[model samples]
Target: MKPKELTRAIVQAFIIIVLLIGLYQVVLSIQSVLSYILIAAVVSLVGRPIAQLLKRIKFGNTLSSVTTIAILMTTFFGIVSLLLPVIFEQAKNLSLLNVNAFEATATKLMNELSIYLLDYGVDLQSWVDRSLAEVDYSFLPDTINTVLNGLSGFTIGVFSVIFISFFFLRDSGLLERMVMVFVADKNIKRVEKSIFSIKNLLSRYFIGLLVQITVLFIVYTLVLLIFGIPNAVTIALVCALLNIIPFLGPIIGTVLIVFLTMTSNLDASFASVTLPKTIYVLIGFTIGQLIDNFLTQPYVFSTSVKSHPLEIFIIILVGGLLFGPLGMIIAVPLYTALKVIFKEFYAHNKIVKALTKNI
Candidate 1:
């Protein structure tokens, strides 16, 4: 083949490969719509035992699941409502963060530094005022509107989740029975083991994540409150909830809290006031993470999932990239299912060993 022709062929192959990968990703995104239902089913299975226990005590599964969901909805919506007032107050206060306040704080800081240090000729106040004035605040409203719309859409999904969860809770036994029907009697043991593995692993992962978030929430809340931070509860709750997403969440939370503290305490200036806020965030996250990795996760998840740290990290990254935050949350459970499937498949194949060597 001519060099140009060969190069053209190679380029065509690369483009085809890229297009195939992109198509696969699009399919995965479409699949995520049903993945949400799958997650609700998993959650229902996990909580079905509790529902059944409640049933034995005279509560119907529908009533028990409704009660559980109601409590969950109330807690989540209550927190959101409580925090929104404070957040809106802070957001509206944004309009009040005029150039005058910026200049005043900058002037105060420069004056303080000038008294002790060599003369710094920089006009910090002018610089700050000019920067604040030039800031494009036009997009802020649109950004907030987009976020509100997304949240409204999420509420619609929550209704579907609750609807699906009700049936799974009420007829959870049917789930296993249905699966069993597809398996021959001889394969029943293997299928049962795989199912149990999924249940145990998913339950442990969810419970572990919940415990970690709760611990972090308490730690951050106490630290923020001790430092006299306004809206401490809201900030801490947000930070801790973010911790559920592993590495990326705490970083976003820290930036948010720091900006909030800086804005709320301009009189104190950033340097002097920022220390407590930064320190509290660092300490709370560090301690909470230590407890999760060393004490909680080992007790709850390590044995059940039996996944390596690197594997978990990769799975989380893939999940996040493929399906956004929801994917990240479900990554571990899905990985656990895959792990069980691989183990079962290998065991099944071993039973059908070749009668002769490859020759």
Candidate 2:
């Protein structure tokens, strides 16, 4: 290539690279704002049906929107209020925990296991002692302070989400109008159709998720109570909430349940009291998960989102690979939105047609 031509190409490439880097930095700066907007969008979508029902009953748009937001706020705070006391009490107990007593119990359990495993030449009690000796209790206070410090930011985010959600609920087509600003006039009708379809599907999908959590919460609570576990309701709520993250969530929840169950009765005999209780609790957790997997998940993925189970699984897996848990949580809704857009704008593509056929 000529020197001048090569120089010009290099300058152009440099400019493009600079522009892309600037754009990325801009996105990083405003990510919190973007998160608030996105969360508000989900809230608005979930409350869409309630607003519509109020409208059908002759309520004005503003009144319906306000009422819907009020309901959502009440429900959110109600759950928080119910759980906060239990959480704080548990935290207090943890802060006042008798570390020596806990260590003694643990050592006793380890000794039992060591005796059982003596045939294999494993020194379990020594290992447990070393692990316990290395633990630092000082971090707990700092962690609590960190959480307290974050409450201010959390409050700001909550207010921002509510402000955005109020506008979204009041103006049902606001998001559609925002999207239309970027589309060509010729494609306006198609874009509108896609937005409408996406909203309808996502509304149902989000509601289905709520139902799934509620079902799991009830089942878990029943199981914990039947097993006479301490703070059963609080534990159940935490476990149920974790299921919001797709495939990996239930496994984590199961581990958490088993750990908490065993720890709650740490002073008891490992082979008799603690171990048997943990096993029973695990059985209950398994039954709850079976109901969720077989009944709740299928309806949410298939009926609400109109996506095949295998397709949803693949998308969630890819999402997790790319962005971890947050991606997996949003994978289905984002994929559903893309499917609608593809069906509308790229109907001629055989792949798009097949993937979006149900929609």
Candidate 3:
């Protein structure tokens, strides 16, 4: 390569590396506040419709925004109030567990597994011994402490979300108008239409999520109860809510429910219960998943956002690759907004035409 060309390439590479490092540091600095900001954004989007309705009815913007915040807070705490007692009771159950018996049972199971694997020429016992020898039991206590501390830290973030959401909801209309000023005078109406469409679409998307969660909770609770799973309420609540995360969520939820079913409340009723409780648990979850996949998701993605299922799936995968789980969670809404903006500004570009064709 020529000297000048090499030097220019080197400078560009150096700039890119510095920019990436700076971005990483910025992310680390804002990690705590990012959660609050995301909460505010979601609340503002969901409350936008109700605030508009209030405006139509002649409610003052400040009063309507405050009322919307109150509604969101009350709904959040109402769910928390129901869930907290269940969590506390389960913690009490954990504290009362017989540790020695638990250890003995685990050891016995490991031995039996070792014996079974002997027929296949695998020495599971040796592997278990090696793994146990290297295991750090102290990590368990440290992990528990970290989780408790993290939970306590969120108290401040919760209040921050509410306070931030109020300003966002109150001035949301003004902000929308302000944004339109950046567009050419002739194209301002196009930007306004795009913004209005985004708000309406996102509102439906969020309302659809609440409906999905409620439906899943009811279905999961009923299924677990029929199988006599202990802590069905808490498990159902957790499993249902986990569906909020994209792609990987339902798998995590199902695995957790299966583990709880296998470990809790063993007896003749469990053993002679027609089918193994584990199998029953799987069956129940499979049915619930079918409902979610066939009914809930289609309504949320297709009807609410007007995106094809395959399109939504690909967007989620790309988002997960780029930005991790949070990226996947927000992928639909972000993609929708981008599509609208592109259609508004780049209507003549071929790629833009293809991407925003639906919108």
Q: lDDT values of the candidates?
A: 0.73, 0.87, 0.81
Predicted model with the maximum TM-score: 2
Clash count per candidate: 0, 0, 0
What does candidate 2's lDDT look like per residue over 1-359, in tens digits? 99999999999999999999998688567867876887899999888889999999999999999999999999889867776766575566567767888788777877777999887888877887899999999999999999987898799999999999999999988987888899999999898889889888998898889899999999999999998888899889888999999978999999888877766776566678988999999899999999998888898888899988888899999988865776787788889999999999999899998998888
Candidate number of the best lDDT: 2
Instruction: List ranges where model 1 is wrong by over 4 Å.
Output: 1-29, 88-99, 107-149, 177-189, 274-280, 283-287, 290-300, 348-359
Q: Candidate 2 has what TM-score? A: 0.81
lDDT of 3: 0.81
- How far is 14's C-alpha from truth in model 2 (Å)? 11
List TM-score per model, in order. 0.72, 0.81, 0.79
Ranking by TM-score: 2, 3, 1
Global Cα RMSD, each model? 7.5, 4.1, 4.3
Per-residue C-alpha lDDT of model 1 across residues 207-313, encoded as one tens digit per residue: 76777778878887887787777888888888888777766786777787777766666555466666566666567667766776677655555554666566677
Deviation in angstroms for 281 in model 1?
4.0
The residue-by-residue lDDT of candidate 3 on 1-359, one tens digit each, is 99999999999999999999999789767856875776688888888788888888999999999888888788878867766765675566567767777667667777877899999999998987899899989899889999999788877888888888888899986556657668788987888889888888888888888899999999999988988777788789888989989868899998888666655543223334523778878888889889989889988887778788888899999878866887788788888888888888899999998777766
